[model samples]
Target chain A: MSSTTTTRPNGLALFILPSALMFALFFFLPIGLMALMSVLTGNPVVMPKVAFTTRHYARMVGDPYYLEVIWTTIRIGLVTTLVALAIGYPLAHWMARIKSRAGHALLLMAVLAPMLTGIVVRTFAWMTLLSDKGVVNQTLMSLGLISQPLKLMYTETGIVVGLVHIYVPFMVLTLTGVIGRIDERLEQAAENLGASPLRAFLEVTLPLSLPGILAGSLLVFALAISAYVTPILLGGFQIMTLPILIYQQISANFNVGFAAALGIVLLVISLMLVIAYNRALGLVSGQRELQ
Target chain B: MSASIEIAGVSKVYDGGVRAVDAVAMDIRQGEFFSLLGPSGCGKTTTLRMIAGFETPSSGAIRVDGADITHVPAHKRDMGMVFQNYALFPHRTVAENVAFGLRMRGLDKATITAKVKAALAMVELSGLEDRRPAQLSGGQQQRVALARAIVIAPRVLLCDEPLGALDKKLRQQMQFELKQLQKKLGLTLVFVTHDQEEALAMSDRIAVMNGGRVEQVGTPTEIYNQPTTRFVADFIGDTNIFRGERTTTSTVASALDVGKGLILALPPTEGQGTGVLSVALRPEKIRLITRTDAATAAGSSAHGIVENTNFLGGAVLYRVTLESAHRVLVQQPNAGTSRLFVPGDGVTLEWTPADLVVLKD
Candidate 1:
């Protein structure tokens, strides 16, 4: 080999260099810009010059509109997470327990079909089923359960319902991976120790799958808090969230700096919540043996 | 709790029309360390699972402690099990894993803690209470599995090749440990394994299974030395079998005519035809004799050439091929330093009729 060619980078560096450069450009640069903008808080009309200030952060803390939106986001995220878990745990258990290849294939199709379909298509399908003239309302009315068609769309209920539908597959797939790795013998061991079926589930299966639960909740909660499309389609005009407000600030008002500030605030808060969750759960924490 | 397992003509058929376990019937005594020994797909594991109440028998009934528990679910059977993979909950600490059964049974926190400590100490893992299963080595994990199973003080203990996953040395150690634990606790243990040495070492009584059926049930020595069938003789250990026909009292006459070439002589057995007998002789039971010794005719003998010689630590195995090209193996324990024979040497293999075991074809 030539001297120049022989002096080239090692194999690992050649592989890692390209992805590392791309990550720095697309990820760290935007994060840097957002961080700088969060500190810059001048109304462009009053001061055209780019100046740094903390007024936006102060306003974010003091204003009831921003506080209300944050609280609403948290509430929706928490409820959506809990509801997704309640439904996904059993479904995931059923999927993992199937012994036949065909049964497993059918289950995988059930979970993956909706996941692979377009998100807008799924939301639109739910829209037809949940509308005032939807099948659900018509069935209830014909069954004499209601005098009139109940308004099932354009409310917090609709938002949560849509979010849960969109997020439950995430929980189920995560749980399937975790539950499948668990040796079924532990559950059998529990059963043989005088635990009833329900007791074994509660004590063995549920607790053992907690890592999946934690991961799925973190993912759903993070996604729910920043959800823009579902709330816009289902929550109508009343439920204003941080993402919606940020979108309005940027697109309608053409306030790039303000939008960046809001984005930074949301990002910081979400990261803090993730860190707190990890700490409380006593995650790996550099403790390799515990893992 | 003391319990005896009586499987009355049990059979298990899967949905796809596969018979996993055929009609299997056996009685396991209370507090006995019984083994279901067989090759894979021979229904050993299925039988173990059926006795543990994990799998329901399709046709017959399973009575535990003389009570029919065939239809009862696994959890209500009140047995305890250790698996080959040592299924300790990875998320729980060792103490928590041991205390799981007590907590499920509604024991108080103090009692659970005390029992957990005792159980952990029993497996010699006293200080590993705070460690997760992933933190422990494979052997330690197996001990934790053992502690978890015993902490429940179960009615019966089921071990499905509990030592199969361990290394050879560790497996030997754990085998002794498990046997000692069984004796100390006086607990009924239903073990499953395909290792013959393991089965011979740890079992109080062994049920040799094949093709989803029990071939024989006996102690280790009986299974090895008194095999009733050809399959049993070949499976338990090495043996040299020859085809013969009983000619007189305690003598099996062979087709090979040496005027003195007798296949074997044994006690009379049950069979109708021309006394077609399958005679098995252990390798070490046959002796190598010199030409002068064979000429004297002091013992029943066969003439053959030493085809091969293997020096194994304190024993030597000589493969003797007769003029008929029939090979017989003779193993002799070496009390001195040198071997008595070499390859290509002519010798007479000698053994008395008493050493032969007559097997049904």
Candidate 2:
């Protein structure tokens, strides 16, 4: 009996031990070390001694530049989430209901083409399009809709557009997954129950697709809050966010202690937002079951 | 509370070169529980959808309450429909589901609540208004679907096999309940079902559809007792078919070409002797009697050897092989202590000529 029980746990260990080891090595250990470093105010290069101090956190809260960066990060996340949802819902609805296989394939290709392309390549393409002498400015100028080159590049508008382009696919994919699972007969039943098409959409389709909207919004918001590339390329030091600030503090200033404190603050806020979002949607229990 | 529906020359040719519903016309009178009964892939469902304005008829018109509603959208048609799977919105409470249509019509909050309560009560689900569809059992969800349809007081109600998902006993109960509700509400109902027994038991008039066309339309008794075509006779019930020639309007001399062959005298018919004719006798109509010879039995009697006997609790069913090698199904009620025939027992099958129905091939 002891031998059999030992073999059974060995079989269990074979399946679970790999992931447990990986989590400890790649996730929990690093997070623990990082959190420990957040409190130490000494040089990180050699035997950094632990010293309890909230000075870095206090400095972050008091500095106008850091506060502005935090506000800008949250604002960009909100704007990107809202824009992606607005475009994703209708596109996902169309994909879910169109009966023709060929049409569905075409729509799928359209969504996948941009997503499958590397993020850097897509961002480069957007940069060109938003450039002063690029297609957008030239077209607008030829159409008499704008004066020469209108200074559209390296602005918050450019950053938001690029962010929306990158995150729209995520929102679309999530919404499509949810909307596809909805039984279409409910919409037909709503119509037969004397609801107009618009009313039926509002009362039935919209409410049923809420889970998709919430999930997509959370995903896009998280990605947008942590974004580094698009904002750096487009904001051009004008729109400073926490990631850029953290990178400068660590790499340029070599202020690892201050950077670690800022990193801990950002990580805590992101984790809290994720937890609150899941709780509000009642999706935490569902996600746990899936895990 | 009820409205008549008229479908004229309705047809649906799908994009895949299939005529889902051929040109068909039907009129459902107010307060009538009409059923479209057919096998799968038949046009019954398509016809029902056309009436509900879900599918636009390819070449014809649909009118509800004397208005041409062929061009109107489904929601504007003022009709109610129940799906086979009971398409209740899973995200909403029962009251919210029932009140959706009322809210769409811009009804006030008080009126909506009162009507929602009344509709829930109608389906015997008054206390379940706070429950979501997923929380209810299959039967309760179907009732909620029914209430959601009727809450708006639509002129017509269309049901596409609403009880198709339930077990046999539950289906039977729902059949009775739905029929009772239809009668009680005086609502014109166009129900679609493939189960012949369900059509027979509930419909005021049954339209038996086949391959995108209506084959026959009649009361249950007429459809059972006097099916005009071979398809109708074969589809409705079990019967013994004997091929024959019509000697007259009511008499058919057997085509078996034997001197002592079967002959049937059927009820009167206006049209006769136009084609190959056959007599269909119900299994229960044939009686088994023991006699010294087949000639001693009353009415038309045939001699045969019992091939198999099945005791079905209430009745004894026997498969009898005639001398011509044609097997006839005969059923006899089991009453009192009696001699039950074994497989090899010689028997005489007797039935009155009036029990037979002559069908045109």
Candidate 3:
């Protein structure tokens, strides 16, 4: 027994060594390089001596254009999260409550179908639906709802629409697992105590599904803020989110240090938001229990 | 407040032609404790749900306080239900769960608070108001469920196996407590359970169901003492059933040919010109006496040999093999003075003719 117990840890270490090495090589190395780059003063065109400097961080904080881009990214992230939640909650609830297996399978397919297509392809599909002289504008003009085409393809609203469509499936998938675990008998108990069907749903089903709502919101917000491809394709040059600004600093200007600084800032902000979101959820659920 | 319920020819046929309840009918008086007792899939819970308006009967109507409520929705039926699993909301505090029904009725905050307090106090869970349901013990959660249901002051309370989740001691204690509470509040209650002892202990009248049909409905005494069917007789308690054919007819007695030259005398029953008959006798009603003392007994006696003896806590059960090779069971109370028999002991089993009940199948 002693021999086997001593060898067991060795066996575990051997199994974990491969993934540990891969994580260190692919993940930690890049993060360490980015951190070093963020503080170094150098020109990307030539390999020069590195010197310590805070100018890049200061420039990112002091620039009003970068601040505006950060604020716009955050605003778009928040809007996309709220919109996904608003649409995902009812869809997930419907799917969770469906009695027929075929109905549940069909709804599940609909929720996951967009995910099967590449994000770029889906964004282009949205472009056709929202652009001037596109199907939406042509249909609206034919229906006499509007005489002129709306400016929807190159705006923040267009970016939000595309982002919500891409990320709403994440919300639905997370919430389905949570909502499906809620006992239907609790709703019946509520109704038996004089709550109507609608009241029971609002009182019992909604409150019990809060954990899912919190998790899905956090996931959507984090992904939306970091997203780049969909926003750039949909908003064109009219919108400048943080990711777009970072992309411009790297690819257009060859300012790798500034790009690394922007990436670190974005990471910090996402971390802070996630912490605040968790704290807020804990407070709300705690208060609910004490009520 | 309590209301009388009248179920007239109610039946529930599910999709694909499965009959969950078959034309069950019963009248429950105001402020009475009634039970629907049956095994699983016997439609007892289905009958209770129909009255609670969770299930609509496929045919016939239900009337509460002389008003037809067959088409009414469950929330509008003004009934309270306690589920088997105690369906308390885990997200809400005990006070909030108890206050849900009052809040739904649009009561003011102060009134809701006062009533919630009173209801919690009634179930002896007053101080645990702010605790979540998950934090409570099983009995405490059950009390919270009871308080939540009764806080609405519904017309009739429906409970589906309310005490089925508790341990044996807790179940017995809660059964007595629930009965007392129902009496104190003067509430009409419809309870459903499969345990015959639970049904006997709590219900004023019980409807025993089998195979989606009600086999019998009667008071506990009548159900135990004079069951009308073989199912009720066998289901309610232990009994010995003898299958035979009626051979001779007399005014005071009748003879049943039970094979092997053994003709048992039974009381005269209705429809005596029967082809086949089954007589049920309770084990407790049969007495075992020595073959020498059998001459002094004033009843029909049969010679047998004691095959086995089982010593229960309060009684002893003896299995006897009669001369005709038929096994008969007899239970005698451990009165501390009766002679105990063992295997290979020759004995005579005696029972009054009236104790033998003729049953249909």
Candidate 4:
């Protein structure tokens, strides 16, 4: 309604203004404060920062227990990524090949329905499924496959299963977005060029879908590595990961500086893995020049 | 080796009870450059796909080289197809794309390399083997697709509007090259195209289709000049259709008494007297003469005035309003010796009975 406003050349900039402000306020501000807290002395959340110290970083490097926790955290992320990929690729490919729109929509709903539920509720559902007296062990026992009840809860396996249940939707969504866009004629062309159906998939569809795999795996890995609630509830003090250790420092010990330092370390590790994975994919994918 | 293909009454029906292809049969000889030409959704591409084993006929069969291949999977059928979009492997290098078929067959490394090199050379894309498909222009991508398909040396090659994406000049060039390649290899090539001119220019025989049915199958000359159906006549090129009831005019000649006081003389070869006769007259077949000289004309003649004149680079088309008020189109070559008639010039239209093709309407 103003003359100058109507005459402004960057009319499109108004659309991004709100999201840009929110991102700067909610994302960049928190990360900046966390980085600052990692360096400040004492409990910075409740009390004013008095002095700066490198003691938290020194303590983390000096402690072998912290390093092991980071390594285990990375291992869980890698395993979750691989498992999600294994499950998601087939589902994604099936969704891509489905001829009917209703079938595609139904399958998409089934894949994405779990993520619509709360993470805590999903973790609880997995707990009931994986408990020793749960339906899984009951069914296996009824089938006479296992004479003794397997210890399914409070272990790395239980934690991983819960993490995958919560994060696999992201993988499927990413993969489907990509694989669905690939031209079907390419595979038909491969088959036309004397490739069997399986050979056509391996030679044409697989390499073309590699970028999707990388993107989906990276998304799942980031979420899996940073996850705290599911690991805490499922692993039940038996499994040690960076998020669990950071939670304990903040909730039980009230060590804000140490908690912030651990959070920064975790963020750095995730960033490093993302960069390394991207580099590895660049070598395999002809320098990431996708159309 | 080239192979003959026999489509024995093949039909494809969809879930909605729509027949994409309806009982189409054709005997394609070995080493023939055959084309299925039609408008969109006329079953041309579907027929080609059925021959390539990409689609299954609902109630009929297809054979390749006298062996039934209707139930065979596409990979085992030994046919190479060039898709409209080129469909090159975006991730692979040009050389790798060309070598894919050879690798699938488990050929020796040296032989695959040699064949890939030869195929690239054939398409005039020898030096761009290391470049990815995204790095090349559309014409270059088309060449890559051609090289990839032909390097396999399959029994037959299928092209589904392959050059539809290219510009006009490039499409003509590729059309010439593809025809030459088909001849050089002596391979059976089934081409599907909606472009009638492209089909006429490249195909040894063209099967014109409309509404899920084949209207006619013949050489380019026959399809153009002697169209059997009204659809074929109208679809292939521009034509003036004259429809009227049969009447014997004074026992000397049988003439079709069209509306508006126009009578089209029937050829002597048309013996069967029909209830209603329909004929297609090409625009180029009619001659334009000044009304003062109209008395010297032969065959069916009419007096008209030029209503409009269209100047093409190599030809002139005149839309003449006849004495009966029926509009007739006449095209003449701009050979620079004959006077080009302008609009409002009085003219006489002349055409022999032989120029009128009786339509199976």
Question: Which residue runs does candidate 4 get wrong by more than 4 Å?
Answer: A1-17, A44-49, A286-291, B293-299
- Model 2 TM-score is 0.90
For model 1, the TM-score of its B chain against the native B chain is 0.91
The most accurate candidate by TM-score is: 4
What tens-digit string does per-residue lDDT give for candidate 4 at B105-161?
A: 899999999999999999999899899898999999999998998899989999999
Give a tens-digit lDDT track for model 1, residues A39-150: 7765445767868887777887889888898788788888999999998989999898889889989988888888787777877877888889888898999999998888
Tens-digit per-residue lDDT, B307-350, candidate 1: 89898878888888965577888898987865579888888777
DockQ of 2: 0.46
* Top model number, lDDT: 3
Clashing pairs in 4: none
State each model's CA lDDT, in order: 0.82, 0.83, 0.89, 0.89
Please, what are the lDDT tens digits per residue for candidate 3 over residues B1-361?
Answer: 7999999999999877999999999999999999999889999998988998888999999999999999998999889999999999888889999999999899999999999999999999979988898888889999999999998999999999999999999999999999999999999999999999999999999999999999989999888888888998899978888888877734334577788856767774544564778888899998888876434333266888999999996999999998889898899999978768999999888888788887765
By TM-score rank, best first, the candidates go: 4, 3, 2, 1
The deviation in Å at residue B61 for candidate 2 is: 1.6
Off by over 4 Å in 2: A1-13, A43-52, A283-291, B242-279, B290-292, B295-301
| Kept native contacts, fraction for each prediction | 0.75, 0.77, 0.70, 0.81
Give the range where candidate 1 chain B is weakest over 10 consecutive residues by summed lDDT.
Answer: B250-259
Ranking by lDDT: 3, 4, 2, 1
lDDT of candidate 2 over B140-204, digit per residue (tens): 98998899888888899889999998998988899989999999999999999999999999999
A1-291 per-residue lDDT for model 3 (tens digits): 787667534656788888999999999999888888899887534865778889999997898988888899999999999999999999999999898788999999999999999999999999999999889999999999999999889999999999999999999999999899999999988888788999899999998888899999999999999999989999997899989988999999989999999998888888898898789789757754443
Q: How many clashes does the backbone of model 4 have?
A: 0
DockQ, each predicted model: 0.47, 0.46, 0.46, 0.64
Off by over 4 Å in 1: A1-9, A41-48, A283-291, B108-131, B134-140, B243-277, B290-300, B337-340
What does the interface RMSD come to for each candidate?
2.8, 4.6, 3.5, 1.7
